[model samples]
Target: MGERVQTVIVGAGVIGLAIARALAQAGREVIVLERHGLIGSEVSSRNSEVIHAGIYYATDWLKTRLCVAGRKKLYPYLESHGVAHRKIGKLIVACDQEQLAKLSGIMEGARVNGVDDLRLVSAEEVHEMEPHLACTGAILSPSTGIVDAHGLMLALRGDAEAAGAMIAFNAPLEGGRILDDGIALDVGGETPMSLVADEVVIAAGLGAQDAAAAIEGYPAEAVPPIHRIKGNYFALSGKSPFERLIYPVPVHGGLGIHATLDLSGRVKFGPDVDWDAEPAYDVDPARGEVFYEAVRSYWPGLPDGALAPDYAGVRPKLTARGEPARDFVIEGPETHGVAGLVGLFGIESPGLTSSLAVADHVAALLGYGKAQ
Candidate 1:
């Protein structure tokens, strides 16, 4: 017989932390199981850290709804909690007249997704804003910004802890069994243990599918196939040439390789979608050759030998290669026939920006519909 707990959230990444905070603040006894000693050690830490403007995803997607709503909630929380962030804004540039036509559609998509502040800027306006940029035109998203990812996680953890959520570090979800009333999870760590949870949320990002497949009686068919789509990045050696984030027209599989700035004003490029790459994080220097060419298409002044491989991240995509991207999967009992179990899948780029709202959605799935 395992000890019974009120709620258990697997994974302590940004989404899990945010969900834990919400449940705890709602007065639910929450326990978070983390496989790593440090929070956000995997997919959460290694990324561009840009706050998406809910522009790219479809108008009806959970990505768009939650990202727009989460961005609204996130800014105030960051300011109130003293987290480091900046609304430095972003530009979706068009390299040619054909690409310029795409910008209008992008702006319309953004408006449909509740991002109404985007402005279609002329090439002259683009150069005025970023002198080094040589785009034919661009869509300026003022609500887009950057945040300290680790800092935001710390704040979420703090709030959850203050509200009575306990996170067990190095506690991996080995497996679990579905019970009559709830679910019992087998967790492995320095010391293995089992806990029966009244509710379970699989917010394991990259490991979401594995986590879902492990639990006995969890619908195997309901667990969506995960594609390991990798993106590689490169950093600029010198001072940043742009004040704001720069982007190109949306490409297949991703929003194309673009320029992103961290909160410290350091510039980096890429996350060019590597469809056939292995599930590894090594950034091949040879890949920089592709980044140089892609960046020069919009920023022609990019000096030679300036790009150096920085890092890479893999997205847990639901769709296969060449298929259109899918929406966030917030599967609950209604959809899966498994009471008190919710699985979050395909949470990739806009995830950080959508954490808070996704948390609320997870809570709603568990019958706590109101956001606390």
Candidate 2:
């Protein structure tokens, strides 16, 4: 609103905020623009907040690399910043002989992704760890854990601000024009004004497609379309009995309705995947019917009516239903021919865990190393 910034980030989600912190730490003049009143109001806030263990993605892709690198970087950052989190571990349980047969391949995949410490535990050992869980076998991933996403975002915001980054909330970006010097942004408000930036990064998540269309000469069609995949969760009424996070074998669309504990030890289950044409955040209580059937598969004694709709999060999926899942898409000058512009799409699931690594990658893409 005042003057052009050296760098402008067009979203204040976790990904954007982390990049801001990284760039600002390098002493760049940074300004973060957020359409919402607060940071992380979209998909960043509405997620499982599970720090992934580098599984489920093909080894060569960005998701696999960033997730693996991010998992290694996240715990140290959390501890250094005093963010609340737990290394409470995760179990990929095999409920039947068919799923049991897939455990070896899953382990092999984890190994390929550099996810060490994955142990194939017997059903007897699983029962010893989680008394009520039913399973033929399970893979123990000690690195997988839960994080306080809000707290982590706060720390990143504080660090960025301390490094002289200015964050402007409620400053929705209307559109932009590519000028000879740089991109000029048309911002909305009571007194709308145009501001120029030497560089711009669009980490707008689900809104990325619209953001891409705003930039001249940028291929909107090449940017993969976003599909809203809604995942619904249910909170357990009483105190949690399980010590570790309990999960079932990975299903086609999502990780099965797994039991996850917050840092406070309150238990919740779910995130069963449902594809929708329009993105909606409504959490339907009726979905409890499907939840009971799915959850009871792992926790047989789940009391009737103990589970209630707690929350819902939508995933910005690059691939549609019945298609193979795709990797993270980070578009830069080489791909789009727009120097100093980077766009990120299909960043879901492991996004929180991969925040720092993703930021580093974006920084590299922006010619930060070359600038040095």
Candidate 3:
């Protein structure tokens, strides 16, 4: 028999780390099994790192609730813990009259979703805020910001470890069996081992579906189809043109390719959605062509050959191609008939913004603590 733990969280990404912290803080014995040698090596590090303001989601969606709540919870924690971050705000621009009219609906939807701080600004205001921007109108989201994601993860790991949560890096979940009172997991690493966990949470970002399938006795029908979309980011060679983040109105399958700044005020444009079969992190040079056209829509002064491939992140979408995006699917015993197992699916954008709330929800689903 292998070691027995009160809880075993698969994946040590932000959400997994947050969940470990929450559960460990609740006096539960937690062990985080990470396939990679370091935490945040996958989806956690490969993201826009922007803190969303819960504006784009529907009124009743989990993304809206968790993102808003998580953003609210995150700012204070980041400040209190001395995490580097900036609430520099964001601008959603509309270049044409048709797109400009869509801004109202976006604003209305944001309001319905409890994000009342978003304000519609005229073309003059947009230009005043960002002279290089050429939009007819814009929606300013004051609550949106950027954060040092790795620093935040370090804090979460510290908290979890302080609370007795043990993180075993390089221990990938190979497969598992659902035991009578708990689940057994086969973990692969430098030294292979087996573990029996009273509770299990599959928060594997891109590997979520595979993690679910690895668990024996899990309902096959409950596993949703996954679609992978590669979002690539491009770095600017010169000084950033704008102070605040600039985003065009959303497009099919994603928020349009937008420009965002890091904590150091360096600008990068990205994440143009490219459907793919497998995960690819390479930033193709040819893809830079599309970014120039996209960025020029908002900033016409963009210089040719100034854009270069920077980094890329893959979004594991739960919705199929051409299908409307779906909500965060957090399945617990109620859905799978498996006691003490929860799987997170379709946690893409707003996931970083919603990490804490997602953790609280997952912990509450396991009957550990209240989601606040």
Candidate 4:
């Protein structure tokens, strides 16, 4: 007979750890299952670790709501937990006159989403703020910042462990079946075991769909398709030209190849979206050629050979290329017709920022609080 547990959180990424912490703090006996031996080896630590200001998403969308709510909780949590972070702000620049109207439109949308701190700046004002930036106009998002992603994940893991939550590393959720009493999960890896959990949360980033399908009886039609949108990064060799993060107006699939800094003040630009990418991380040097063109649109002072292929990350997008963007799908029992089961699909971008709030919502779905 397999062991019985109160809850099993699939994937020990930021979202899973956050959920484990919340549920454990709520006094639920929780277990977090991770395929990797260490925590947060995938989506949690990849890409720009920016604390978004809830500006880019739709006004009434879950992305905006959770991001806004999560950002509010995250700053205080980071401070009290002693995590390294910076409120260094961000700029959404319009590099040419043609992009100015769109810049203002983004500002208006942001204001509608309760991003009250956004300020419109003229070319002269932007130059004063970022000397290396050449823009016709810009939106100064003072609340946009960056955090130590690894530190944040560790903090979440520590909190979950402190609350009596156990994490099983190298424990992948292979396959399972829905039972009347509980969901029986087959744990795969070395020393494989079986676990019948009263509740399960599929927060497995790119593998979320497969995890959900493994549980026999989860609606096949409900599982959203996963698109591996790979975004490549290029690290700068010389001193960082800008002080704060600099963003171009968003492209179709991503926030563009914006300049983001780590806590050490090192600049890395990237994540130019690759629609037809496999689950790989190799950064081709030839890709740097495209980065040079994209980056020089705003910072024309970029010197040749300054960029070196750094790393790449793939986001589990719900939409295919050319389709309109979809909202974050935190599917609970009420929607999926599976009791005590919640599957999170397409939880990209603002996902790290919204981790805590998403945890709260997951708890609510499991009968803890109101889902808001």
Highest TM-score: which candidate?
A: 4
The clash count of every prediction, one per candidate, is 0, 0, 0, 0
List the candidates' TM-scores in order: 0.98, 0.96, 0.98, 0.99
In candidate 3, position 188 carries an lDDT of: 92
Give the candidate number with the greatest lDDT.
4
What overall lDDT, based on C-alpha atoms, would model 4 receive against the true structure? 0.92
Candidate 3 — which residues are off by over 4 angstroms?
none
For candidate 4, the clash count comes to: 0
lDDT of 4 by residue, 1-372 (tens): 589999999999999999999999999999999999999888888869999999989887988899999999999999999999999999999987888889878988988998899999999999998999998899999998999989999999999999999999999889999999889999999979999989999999989998998989889988999898898999999788999999998999999999999999899998899887676989989989899999999999999999999999989999998999999999898898889999999999999999999999999999998786
Candidate 2, residues 42-128, lDDT tens digits: the string is 999988889889987898888899999988999999999999999999999998899999999999998998998899999999999
Model 3, range 1-372, lDDT digits (tens) per residue? 688889999889999999999999989999999988899887889888899999999888877899999999999999999999999999999999999999999999999988999999999988888899999999999999999999999999999999999999989899999999899999998989989999999999889899989999989888888888888999999899898999999998899899999998888898888875357889889988889999998899999899989999988888766889898888889888999999988888989889989989988888876754
Clashing pairs in 1: none
On a 0 to 1 TM-score scale, where does candidate 3 land against the true structure?
0.98
Q: Candidate 4 regions off by >4 Å?
A: none
Q: Candidate 1 versus the native: TM-score?
A: 0.98
Error of 1 at 95 (Å): 0.4
